[model samples]
Target: MLDDFMTRATLAGIGVAFAAAPLGSFVVWRRMAYFGDATAHAAILGVALALALELSIFAGAMAVALAMALTVSALSGRGYAMDTLLGVLAHSALAFGLVAVSFLSGIRIDLMAYLFGDILAVSRGDLGVIWSGAALVVGLIGWRWSRLLTSTLSPDMAHAAGINPRHEQLILTLALAITVAVAIKVVGVLLIAAMLIVPAAAARPLARTPEAMALIAAGIGAASALVGLRAAYVLDTPAGPSIVCVAATAFALTGLYSVARKAR
Candidate 1:
């Protein structure tokens, strides 16, 4: 009946995979992997604020992630290089977050869990949060798929179509924030970027079109979540990192296959 914590954990993992995979494809297409990482790293700071103010961690994380994403979007047009800006923001947020977390007096915190996740510890309430957040991200992506793709292919093309490229970017930013909020429970901040990138990258060689890539990436992500969960159970390893490791391995194999096919 799969009606236990393990079931909840598995469901949470799958939900996150579903939401993150398609968005990951856009991230790969636009080369925004670093931006995703920066927003995720800001989650640590959110955790600190949440604990300090006695708020929900999810809410805090979401707020911080949105703020970070918006800030980047606003600044990206103002003479700042994208990679450099994200690098500065990502490391600074993480450093400040660690410092802030250290100041919470007499409270025992599982820092490792926030960094690497503890999926097995997820509860029914967490499952609700995960699925809800995932649904929002997926729905938003599906609703704006065409415009988003247009903007991604070329901002001028999007403008000519009367679609505001900036608006599409904001939609992606919103989706990224929600994904980060939900994913923290399943994969933690350290591995969220991996979840957002690896599956999409792995699916690249096998996919002939953008839509095909997104679908295949989602499938790969879901399979990795399930398979990695089982591997962690048997091997007694960290579930979040184990999943990322499996995804990386899959990416490498696909890359090799592509190379082999081209050589033939």
Candidate 2:
């Protein structure tokens, strides 16, 4: 029974890793880590809405993330700094979510679990949602990889080449929303952004191309999930944080190696 439980947890973790790694590569490349954090912080509001309306957590998170992305995209055109806007929205939404959760009197919800995640509690149905969302995200990214690369490398160049940077941005934002929704369940709102950034960061120094970076990020993420799960099991620690620690460790090691190579 214990073995079966661990197997399911591990599988779920792997799914999260696969989904997070590729998307995280984009996040790192675009310097959208703060945007990711903003979207993820808003997920708590989605959780509250889900509980209030009896909707699925995944659906609620996706809805909120999509709304947040749209809001940010629209606001980006208003001449305000993007980081400032993201900071306001992220913290404000998190505060509001906390207040909303406090309003529910009867049920005792573990806010920490939602904030930091409880991956061991993931159900088979949740796994289905994670995989389906992951497939959609990966397929969309793959289909537009060239365009995305063009836009990321140089918006002016992409525009000169007739690719619509705005449209690509929208597509990437949508994909990010889906990713945040799917990942929130695995790593929770507070830590979801880490899952999206850490593995990609770790892979950056080792990659020579955008595609190589993404693939390596995915491999690192998958390995982190497995290693993190093992650590959690042995140390009786929380799964999500343990997984993040592994990713961070990898990032540190990669950074050191890069520095050494540069010095040589």
Candidate 3:
């Protein structure tokens, strides 16, 4: 029974890591870490809504994340600094979500589990949601890969080639929303951004191209999930944080290697 439980948990974690890595590569490349955080922070509101309305948690998060992404994208065009707006939105949404969650009476919800994650508690149904959502996100990204790469390199160039940067941005925003929704259940809202960023960051120094970075990031994320799971089982530690720690350690090692290569 214990073995079966562990197997399911590991499989779920692996699926999540695979999905998070490629999307996260773009998040890192586009410097959208803060945007991811803002969307994730808003998930608490989604959770609250889900519980109150008896809706699917995934659906609730997707709705909230999409709304938040649209709001940020619209506000980004208003001549304000993106970082400033993101900071305000991220923290404000997190604070508001916390307060909103507190209003639920007669229910004992472990806020920490939602914030930091409870990967071991993932159900088979949740795994199905994660895999399906991830596949959709990957397909969308694949369809627009060239356009996105062009836009990332130079929006002017992309425009000259007749690729609409705005449309690509919208597509990316949608993908980010889906990614946040799926990943929240794996790493929780507070740490979801880390899972998105750290593996990609670790892969950056080792990659010569964007595609290479994405693949490397996926590998790193998968390895981290496996290793972290083992460590968690052995040490009786929390799974989510253990996974993130492994990613962080990989990032540190990569950074060191990059520095050494630079010096040589």
Best model per lDDT = 1
Give me the runs in candidate 1 sitting further than 4 Å from their true place.
Answer: none
Runs with alpha carbons beyond 4 Å of true place in candidate 3:
1-3
List, residue by residue over 1-264, the lDDT tens digit for candidate 1. 346877877888899989998899999999999999999999999999999999999999999989999999889868888889999999999999999999999788999999999899998888889989988998999999999999999999999999999999999999999999999988999999999999999999999998999999988888898889999999999999988888998999999999999999
Best by TM-score: 1
Quote the RMSD, in angstroms, for model 2: 1.5
Q: Compute the lDDT of residue 231 as modeled in candidate 2.
A: 99
Shift of residue 197 alpha carbon in model 1, Å: 0.5
What TM-score do all the candidates reach, one by one? 0.97, 0.96, 0.96
* Error at 51, model 3, angstroms: 0.8
Candidates ranked, most accurate by lDDT first: 1, 2, 3
Per-residue accuracy of model 2 over 60-166 as CA lDDT, tens digit each: 88899889988998899598899999999999999999999998777778999899988888777777888898889999999999998899899999999999988
lDDT of each: 0.93, 0.88, 0.86
Which is the better candidate, 2 or 3, if ranked by lDDT?
2
**Residue 107 of candidate 3: its Cα lDDT?**
74
Question: Which 10-residue window in model 1 sums to the lowest lDDT?
Answer: 1-10
Candidate 3, residues 88-205: lDDT per residue as tens digits? 9888888888888888887778888889888888877887888888888878888999999999889999999999988998998898888878888778998888888999999999
Give the C-alpha miss distance for residue 119 in model 1, angstroms.
Answer: 0.5
TM-score of 2: 0.96
Error of 2 at 9 (Å): 1.4
